[model samples]
Target: MNHFASIARVPGDPILSLMEAYRADSHPGKLDLGVGVYKDAQGLTAIPKAVKLAEQRLLDSETTKSYIGGHGDPLFGQLLTELVLGADSQALAEQRVGATQTPGGTGALRLAADFIRHHLPTRGIWLSDPTWPIHESIFAEAGLQVGHYPYVGADNRLNVEAMLAALNQIPQGDVVLLHACCHNPTGFDLSHVDWLQVLEVVKARELLPLIDFAYQGFGEGLEQDAWAPRLFAEALPELLITSSCSKNFGLYRERTGALLVCARDTEKLLDIRSQLAFLARNLWSTPPAHGAAVVATILADPELKMLWSDELSNMRLRVASLRDGLVTALEPHGLAQRFAHISQQRGMFSYTGLSPLQVKRLREEFSIYMVGSGRANVAGIDAERFAQLAQAIAHVCVE
Candidate 1:
């Protein structure tokens, strides 16, 4: 009589809970560092000028609402492939790389996971110790074994040596999921030298590389941020890359992304893509069109592409500036050294080295919100309130 009564309620996500708490707080100084969305200096989530232009172009020229195939828009996929792997890239030139549109980066990851589960079920997914929390659940939910190598530790530092050491020992042919750039949460990225070392480990241990390239242009320049994935693609006979247009293109809601597969040859890539299309058919019927269309329009047009790149550069620089500004602000409080790594880390987030106790105080006493793990959305910071935040952090650190 009560079939639903057997289900138990689960607690809300911590980040969502923080959002609710932030909204209900009466304090005017309340700061929300919880959500992953980007905010400008004025604290508004902006639509880039290029996006508006592209939307207008779509409005004027669009004709059909018909399905764009299981792989989504062909042009979007083509352009996105070039964007991730250069037009002159060997994979593209040799016709060994394939891409299929997905709902978003998350969808791309799920699609890839399902593809792997169906085709390469024996391969365990190796994630970073402190990777995006959802990665663990996504792969596990797909019935794949999930494992982690060393990454950032409680001391809020990168353990690259440990990471390299662990990767050297993981079972051969297991899949290793690596953030292409702008690593989440900890924001600590492997340097060029470090990546080379990791590549050696990946080669020595014979691990498959699955590069999660969500924030392509969010770290340094677009090309600069893409170095790791490009290197991996060029070096490995086969690689998996999931590219998202959410952050750089400001198409967060539109959910534009692609799952890219590179193989040793065209025939293998064809077989692999066929499998992905089959998995995608059951997953979402077909990916959304408007976002992919918009992305295609912008990337294909020379003028619009330049404008979009400039705007993306602005966003990337703004976040980097915020990192520096926060550090400069912290200097007066004498806490700069403790959190110096924040400046060194590139991306929209930083592990501020604050313990859970200090973070609790910031939430309850100062109306400042961040994840319990001390992960702060550096983009959500108010440039004007740097000193105030520094003072608040200083107080919490000492008191």
Candidate 2:
């Protein structure tokens, strides 16, 4: 008998399964709101102008294809640290912050999880109830006890009060994983006042904050989106931030990101970075070079940096417009009240509040592919098809 024959098959992820189903859908107008990817008005994920230019420059000024390092690109780590923490951050000035590039946000998260499990063995992690689904599995896979704090309510609304209440009860010195900007699956973000309140609780309880800054520019403006993380860095003596270039830089396939570690002093930071490098050696050895190099090239050059910023701003504006447009499209159908939160929510996703049955109807009857939980990718909404999409939404919402 074969020894390896008893492995059980696991079901595919609902989101990826939805994508497969959407692809097999022969409907000419099938819309895909399942995957958490940005799509333009024309329904294409085009590379940014700056990214294209940077790639060209890289091709021309090509050098040896040697390995980057355990920390990948130093320039990328430095630039991304500033981008996430702000240039004037005292943390940077004090040399208390350090970064190590990972494969992507997911990899950075896994790195952080493993680091915590290995180093801070006693500390459990607290995540939002409806956080990016991967957060649960990542920490658990690291053998860390994962607890959830209330975030979104049963009504599919931002229950910040409940979130704070839960946070208050978390064990002291536990790692609290937070979406630094643009809360995923449900685009509801905390206000400035809310951040301050959360900060107070974290300070009081002495919880370690592990911020996941995936969609920085996709929320508000670039600088504005960094507000919460910057605030956290300033208030806390130590922090762990995982920043991704997937959404903002359109480097989705490149898998470029970094795990940022902030300590009370340079000594602690260096030790933390050494441990991360050791764990990373056992993981991927070194992160991919192409994507990080592209990001560094764009950010270091003044002209390319400006162009990239403008492109990022365009993507942000487009997503915001899509959210507003969907809400407006529903107004004439008398759904303004029912779907007002769509306009209010931030980033690519919206907890549209459509029931599972309704979501099934939308996919089967209207060829609109969205998560069964009604988390639609607002970025995938085609500008010209707003009215048609609204009609489908209204029909299902009423049925």
Q: What TM value does model 1 have?
A: 0.99
Instruction: Assess the local accuracy of residue 163 in candidate 2 as a C-alpha lDDT between 0 and 100.
Output: 91
lDDT of each: 0.92, 0.93
Task: Report the lDDT tens digits of candidate 2 across residue range 40-155.
Answer: 87899999999999999999997879999999999999999999998899999999999999999999999999999999999999999888888889899999999999999889
Native-referenced Cα lDDT, model 2: 0.93
Q: Which stretches of candidate 2 lie over 4 Å from their true place?
A: none
Screening candidate 1 with a backbone cut-off below 3 angstroms (N, C-alpha, C), the clashing residue pairs are none
* Model 2: how far residue 303 lies from native, Å: 0.6
lDDT of 1 at 122: 94
lDDT of residue 139 for candidate 2? 90
* lDDT of model number 1: 0.92
Question: How many residue pairs collide in each prediction?
Answer: 0, 0
Clashing pairs in 2: none
